[model samples]
Target: MKRILLLCALVPFTFMTSAQNSRPNIIYILADDLGYGDVSALNKNSQIPTLHMDQLAREGMVFTDAHSSSAVCSPTRYGILTGRYNWRTRLQSGVLWSYDPPLIPESRTTVASLLKQSGYHTACIGKWHLGLGWQQGENGKVDFNKPILGGPTAIGFDYFYGITASLDIPPYFYIKNDRITATVIDSIKGATGKGFWRAGPIGNDFKHEEVLPQLTQKATDYIKEQAAGKQPFFLYYALPSPHTPILPAKEYSGRTHTNAYGDFVLMTDDMVGKVLQAVKEAGIENNTIIIFTSDNGCSPSADFKELKAAGHYPSYIFRGEKADIYEGGHHIPFIVKWPGKVKAGTTTATTICLTDFMATAAALTHRALKDNEGEDSYDLLPLLLQKGVYQRTYTIHHSIDGNFSIRNKNWKLEFAYGSGGWSAPREKAARTQQLPPVQLFDLAKDIAEKNNIAGKNQEIVKQLTHQMEIIINDGRSTPGAKQSNDVPVNYLKYR
Candidate 1:
């Protein structure tokens, strides 16, 4: 007890204590690949109206410079859960494949586990992209009958119901806890455009169109059920919509009158509305901390050309799309609503990363994290409560190709010259065309990143590069005891 109190004392701010032994119920809603401009409240020019997301923005605090730690889905999810840079893990680039071993070690302290330790009931519904430990039979086939290992249940979630990876990944089925709810006895074919899913083995009950709705129902059901309990509950509801297999249910189809993807965005918003409605109906709205944000920027599969034709820009004036090191890839919409605790219609441009959730959660619960845990996380309670300036000094961004970029105030330094992912002037092309080896931009002067001023700004480049090296070598951005990364992170050597 003394040690715990001492650690808590080391924390920067006083613990958020609404009432004795009372903690706010937390609901974290992560939209899969939803763009910064997709929310109408964030982007004035967005053609698709995201009423639910917009409502959250209007009622809560909107962060203009919020970013996912990585420019892709899996890495961003990893950072959010563990509060450590995904590059420090074995998955330096790209996403985990279906049937891959668990990305997070069983002993790692996750946000779910942390809350659970603090006497909160935790549940995770929808999209577990951080890989699962699936047992294989002698014939090299997945043993669906055997209980899966190293999943959400192993990590600390009391309840977990979600697909293994991205909806596009193969072996489609749902897992309740560590068991497969159904058997995979069918096969599927790959698709193109908005309805894009890889061809693979599928379960008898799995359907692309029903995934979003079913997950939504599960989330609402959980909220309603948990409201009756005396214990505070933490619900990490990750929506799989508006990502791929853009199959908006019949009711939402063509609802946007712009494109299939736009209609799908509406469907996503409806899911958010349902969750919000569930909290209100349960009478927990006043005591719940609701956060709505995206894992990463909108994927190119959303048909950027078609959306542009319709005058809707998902990236919203950003230079690149998903898998990029630019603002469009990692910069995302972040809204937090806690009735009476947060002022409505407030906005802050202070830069923050998704990894900050860890320390923020620690602050809320009045628990201090050890040096090894939440290595890259910083507490954002100050910014959320409008108490003072944010504690984050700089943010490190990662691309799908493992390239690194450091953002300090108005300047950004990209280690790679090209887009680093699927954007134009790829690594090979950039090198062939004799482009600069490194690119630096003064984001204050050129938010679009049209100008590369590295030639004239060598000192700023060197300074940011040094800071990045220190952050990488120290294995943490926050002040703490020295820690070791799971693996050596060599961001300079890109694939």
Candidate 2:
């Protein structure tokens, strides 16, 4: 009887150990200012071949209605890592400056922190726009060489090899931890030729054009290093490609038939291929869960006119681009692949968001996260691995201008009178033409958001408004959750 009882106890322990060990390595690849229709797999009309990203989508699950929490870079990154809305933090309307202090509070729990606790090695390579504290001047001037504070390392990433902001931002250099590998002692002006870099300090070898090549190499290198390590790692590879001042390496330059933007996209595809190669070389292909996504929809400046002239619509069937509350602004290509784990050639129209990453990681690690934490994140592992079905009840979208929009089932609610965010030049001009106070669209019918049926559906308008308020007053999307008194100013928020 004693032996039998001991064996019974050991059975559960064995299952628990195996469950914990089964946690696959995670590689979260994020793109900047990429459109939903950019990938050929996502948009059949795409001219430039995104074979790598498309192969990823075809091999795994493609989330058709997925979105980013915010329609911009910094805010979206903040939401993705912490599984919390950026508005609740010190940040408000605009994005972070290159030298802005770290946006994430050390007290907050991030996906990386949770994974680290579960013995996962975490690294962030590429664009880390979430703001890193700088050794700044009393009057916005500081010792550039000083060890920067309150960045990825402090938050949870065991290794951080990326920049603090986008390429357009000043202090144009790649920061490895706190110090810049390449610096700008002299003023290196932007393509606009207006802004100037100060002469305070710069790293020895930093150059504007050198950033992309180095970053790509560093990312692949990190993957190779991690693959050889005994400890499993979580790589958040946020690429700053096909964004502003789009520049591609000589090998990829002029390689695309579209334009410079297309060429840059092809370059990004090459980067993905190289990273995937690293994964394969590591022989951990089946054990690594690889995800490729974008921060938000494409930006208006993506040479869309040029792309359209070539019979390509980067926004695809979507009506808007980045910053807009429309589908294009947040609806992005989300592909997840884990061989032998996630079913191949799968596609899920299930509405999802980057915020779900936290809860998924937490649940996978068997870490107990209170309801108040990761307020909007949902665990989708069951659906991804076990063929379980998940119906996301409600997905929220926030514009750069602080507009709030929500999609519940087939109906989408936008409370703004404007185009919501920067959709297109024509859409922006159309805002002055005509619009409703509260626009409601049955996305199943009007996927392009051409019609506003709010006047016809008063009940949904009322219900959606109430639901939006619940999220606002509670300071979170989760039921009955409220932000502490220290909640920052959420100016220009929903009416």
Please give the TM-score that candidate 2 achieves against the real structure: 0.90
Superposition-based RMSD of candidate 2 using all C-alpha atoms, in angstroms: 4.2
Give, for candidate 2, the lowest lDDT window spanning 10 residues. Answer: 193-202
lDDT by residue (323-377, candidate 1, tens digit) is 9988898999999999888889999988999999999999999999999999999
Alpha-carbon runs more than 4 Å astray in model 2:
1-21, 137-140, 193-202, 386-391, 424-434, 479-482, 485-495
lDDT of each: 0.90, 0.78
Q: If candidate 1 were superposed on the true structure by all CA atoms, what would the RMSD be?
A: 5.6
Q: Give me the candidate number with maximum TM-score.
A: 1
How many clashes show up per model?
Answer: 0, 5
Expressed as tens digits, the lDDT of each residue in 28-102 for candidate 2 is 999888888889888888987999998897779888988898888888998899877776666655588866778
